[model samples]
Target: MPLSAASRPGGAGLDFARVLMEVPHGRLSGTLLVTGDPGGRFHLENGVILEVTSPGSPGVETLLLRSGRVTETDWASAVRSGAAGWRVGAELVARELVGSAELQLICAMAALDGALAMGMGRIDRVALDPEPPATCFAAPEGIEPEWLSRESERRIRALGGQPVSPFRDRLSRTDAGTRLLDDGIAGERRDILQRANGRRSSRDIAFLLGRGLYAVTVEASRLLHEGLVDVAPPALGAADGPAPAPEYGRNPEPTGQPGRTEEASRLPRRRPGTSGITGVLPLRPVSGPWRPPTALTAEDRRFGSAQ
Candidate 1:
């Protein structure tokens, strides 16, 4: 569904990375709902990403099932029991089926994976669902938005030299491919290669493997470069053409200006107390008297001297 201007609040031009930058810096507490192609909801607390859920990718439940950590019956039971309160994690923990730490780790991975998948595609609209202060189950503590953006950029850079497009390219193993034993391919890549049948797109392979699109694409790209596989452009009646190149997390192009870096020269300086928006909660200023003490006080010094 298309998001209206009122729902987006941050304006239509804001992409995923930009939205992420704005939320954390503004310390906004709510769910940032992204719609269209690679849609998802980013749950934030004090501007930190607690969890991210995307319809385009496999969620925690699917990941757990595909990993063989939980049986389908067990997952179904948990979901049925926890549906009223949305406490599947709590249910599993209470039943001792999965450890709290393991659950947290899995959930964190799922959220990051979903976010990464969303990052690879276009973000059509962004809406804020203002939620009250509350605790989250299996939520990562204090995950910075900038860190996510940087990680996304790094992943994109890693795929910089890839010849096959992640969106449109369909891959098939080369006829020279042999059994898995001698070729040295193992783990996720092996699994991905096994499923590549010239019919499925990278997104399909990701869903089949319960892996992230970015990961599958990167691996497939490597395989293509190695001549182990071949890529075909989108067939007729395919989904929309390849999305525009990512905008927000990419490195800024040089303007050819002297004595200035692209980032330093082009980006606008964020004004203090700007709120980062006209509605909802305003950004909390970093400057304050509560800054950490740099050194021991006179009393502590005197006490140490006496000792």
Candidate 2:
């Protein structure tokens, strides 16, 4: 299917694409508003697909596909019919498209990209109707509504302030550290890293992975040490004050030991020269035998007379 392009009333160029996405929240339901113009592509996971609806915000002249409005097949057919168009690379998974997974994966990627782009101020906030499926709002001073969700707005703010790919060099510089994104690093790493967004502690990462605090501390430290990530200090004067110091390297050992030395100290000690016994029994020396005879003399004489 061809990728669609349009021009919004406000002089901003719009581009739209279709993708299948999988979100942690749920399965694929319908099409979503993808991006303004020249924004990064979004993807959720391998099995998800998403269809981009707006390359250019068409204003009232064109129809914007609202979230949760259509299915993957619906979007696919629309694209083939020229009513809608696919984004670049959307065609790759055309054969394997699974409604929920592919679409949601696409949504996740788009969500991340949208969040990042939103950070750059490419898009503005608009009034969104509050409901189970939240709405988003962003608009320039006097234009028609540009909707963004409260959550989406926050994500954009958090992601937009940082350098893209904080760990790219570290991931590439060494074999031991490089995730290489081999098979791609999109799963847990991406999930945790995105959530980290500078607010989470290394201990949090440790807990999340069920790993030792030291392990998580090292991993996070590696991310920072390699310059692939950074910690986000709390906003100035927020009532929360300073974020409490991270209790790093504090996760207890899996075997219930606080640390190795303490467990080793609890083991029973060996006593010197106690090989035969555990030293629970005392050793005694053997004595040579000696005979006693006075009480038996009378009985011995009688025995000899009878013989």
Candidate 3:
């Protein structure tokens, strides 16, 4: 089937924490597409997350290629070898590029980080696109949504108010720290310094270096705090106040208005005897003799009250 779009919101500032929670609450199985400044897809099976893809998170391919675990030729060849799109992980495992446990772990991390990316940005609308992507290195059993959402929310709160967001702010080396930055910089910090050219963001750097987006953002924040990097203006999907709610139990605000009177609001009560029946239950025609329908007596009322 075609990937049709649905559930587009008509209002602004739509928070999709409710929809994200609904997947687990209803035990939904499909690809939940979140669309906004930096939205992405959450692929779930039987309400557990199989994989997730977001601009703020690096996938298995990026992690494998950019980290020099595999070359482009091998990656492309393996992709061609997958006939049904789900065996790429097995293919890599067979070739000894990555262990099965390592692949599952990477898929789980990608899902968690993707969810964090969704919460970090503004979510305009959420819709279920039943069709998942053709090819993705998904975890075999998948991760539970409750655990995934909570952990992602924890990471987001820890990253609160940082100068550099994964997809929002770009950074550049500070002129004042030019000599200091190049003096003894090495490892991840040095790699980030090389990419922080006032154009690319933490998301870009993560894709380029096969590192996690949140880690790159935190390091960039450290650089900014230490007077080594200067951040550019806020990008399209900068983090805002009122972080998304993590739990699925969150209730939406009530939109119904109350009536002025009890009678006005109440439905017509038409239970058993409200129809003015003149006989007791099993009110049927007599077989042998015609008889008048007996009216309710005081004893019957007393018996009813006793019951």
Clashes of each: 0, 58, 0
After superposing candidate 3, which stretches have Cα over 4 Å from the reference?
1-15, 82-86, 131-135, 233-307
lDDT (C-alpha) at residue 266 in model 2: 17
Instruction: List candidate 1 segments past 4 Å from native.
Output: 1-16, 82-84, 132-142, 178-186, 237-307
State each model's CA lDDT, in order: 0.54, 0.28, 0.58
Candidate maximizing lDDT: 3
The residue-by-residue lDDT of candidate 2 on 204-297, one tens digit each, is 3433343322223334544555555555533333222111111222322234432332221111111122111111122122121211123322
Q: Between 1 and 2, whose lDDT is larger?
A: 1
Candidate 2, after superposition: displacement of residue 284 in Å? 88
Per-residue lDDT value at 213 in model 1: 61
Candidate with top TM-score is 3
Error of 3 at 226 (Å): 1.2
As for candidate 3, its clashing pairs are none
lDDT of 3 at 214: 66
Q: Is candidate 1 or candidate 2 better by TM-score?
A: 1
Model 2 gets an lDDT of 0.28
Q: Per-residue lDDT for 146 in model 3?
A: 60
